[model samples]
Structures are given as structure tokens and as C-alpha cells.
Target: RVFDVLVEGQLAIPALDLALEAGTYTAVSRQYTVKVSDGQLNVRFATRQGATLVNGVRVSERPDKALP
Candidate 1:
């Protein structure tokens, strides 16, 4: 089973080095919003269930991949 945790209102993903024990793989989509104001930046992630508000971090000016 996939476990999702929210820290300080932000969703935190487990480190990639961890191995999954057993479960059928499923596709999941995550959406994020980045906002900037007064030189301060904020990010939020949204999923089908609900939304998570992130703080103290900003999206990179140049994303390695662009979204359509």
C-alpha cells in the first residue's frame, strides 16, 4: 500500500531508497501550485482527495521539465 503523509500541511514523500514490500502498482497524479509574493514563495499540492499547503519553500526558477 502507498502511504502518504502530510507534514506541516505539506505532503511528504518517502525517500526513494526505501523498498516497497508488496502491492499492486497504481498510477497517481499530483498537482502543485507555486506562488510568489514580497520575495516570499509558497507551494501547495493538490490531489483528488484534497489539497496540502506547503510553506518555506519555493519552486526553482527553471524547472528541469516544463508542464503543458
Candidate 2:
């Protein structure tokens, strides 16, 4: 699950800490890679699934602010 993401001018997240704790493995960190490409920016998403919270705090909102 993506807890948070931030991009600038439609950039990419070079490095992010990700983990999988399913049947795939008890736990694994930084074993995945994320890629960002153009022509498909500002993709719209629905909130019909309601809100996703982490540690009792909301964090499902997609990033919209530009990074320097």
C-alpha cells in the first residue's frame, strides 16, 4: 500500500521504502521499484472506497503539491 507519494512536474520517486507482508513473505523492504511516465499524468481516482488510515490517521490522499 502506498502511504504517501509526492512528485514535481510529473516526476518519479527515485527511492521509496516499500514492504510486503502477505503470503509472499513475512516481511520484505525496498524490494520493489516504482516508475513514472508522461502522457498519463493527473490521473483521477475515486474515494468511493472511503478513507484509508494509518496509525489511526488519514493518509490515503494522493499528493498534489509540487516538489522542488
Candidate 3:
């Protein structure tokens, strides 16, 4: 399955609850979207000083075992 996310013309991530299953990912700088497939958990992110961190890591798509 595939999911399409659009940040539209906004420059911030939307505040909502989500759950990912496994699929694909697509994001934009400052404003973007992500997609995941079934059985894959949706990863959350936080921006600090223009840097993106997934589960406190400096990169995205980390090992599933490395997740909390």
C-alpha cells in the first residue's frame, strides 16, 4: 500500500496522532509529508536548529530494534 502526504503551503508539521504499518517516505524541508506501509510503525520526528531527528537519531529509517 502507498500513502501520499502533502504539507501543502504550510511550513510546519501538523499536530495529529498517526500510526504507520510499511511503505514509503516523502518529506519536504520545513514542510513535508511521510508514508509508511502496513506492519511498519510510523516514526515521529522533532526539528531543532533546522536539524531533523528521528527518535533522537540524526538520520531517518533507522533499525527497528533501535527504536523505542
Runs of candidate 1 with Cα error greater than 4 angstroms are 14-68
**TM-score for candidate 2:** 0.17
Q: Estimate each model's TM-score.
A: 0.21, 0.17, 0.18
Candidates 1 and 2 compared by lDDT, better number: 1
What lDDT does each candidate get?
0.39, 0.32, 0.34
Candidate 2: regions farther than 4 A off: 1-31, 39-50, 55-68
Compute the lDDT for candidate 3: 0.34
- Per-residue lDDT tens digits for candidate 3, residues 5-54, read 22322323443222233223533233223334454534444333334423
Error of 3 at 56 (Å): 9.9
**Local accuracy of candidate 1 as per-residue lDDT tens digits, 1-68:** 23344443555553211124422343333445433334654333334333432223434553644444
Cα misplacement distance, residue 28 of candidate 1 (Å): 23
How much does candidate 3 score in TM-score?
Answer: 0.18
What's the CA error at residue 21 for candidate 3, in Å? 31
Q: lDDT: which is higher, 2 or 3?
A: 3
Tens digit of per-residue lDDT, candidate 2, span 1-68: 43333332432432223433343224432222223455333422222233422332122323653323
**Predictions ranked by lDDT, top down?**
1, 3, 2
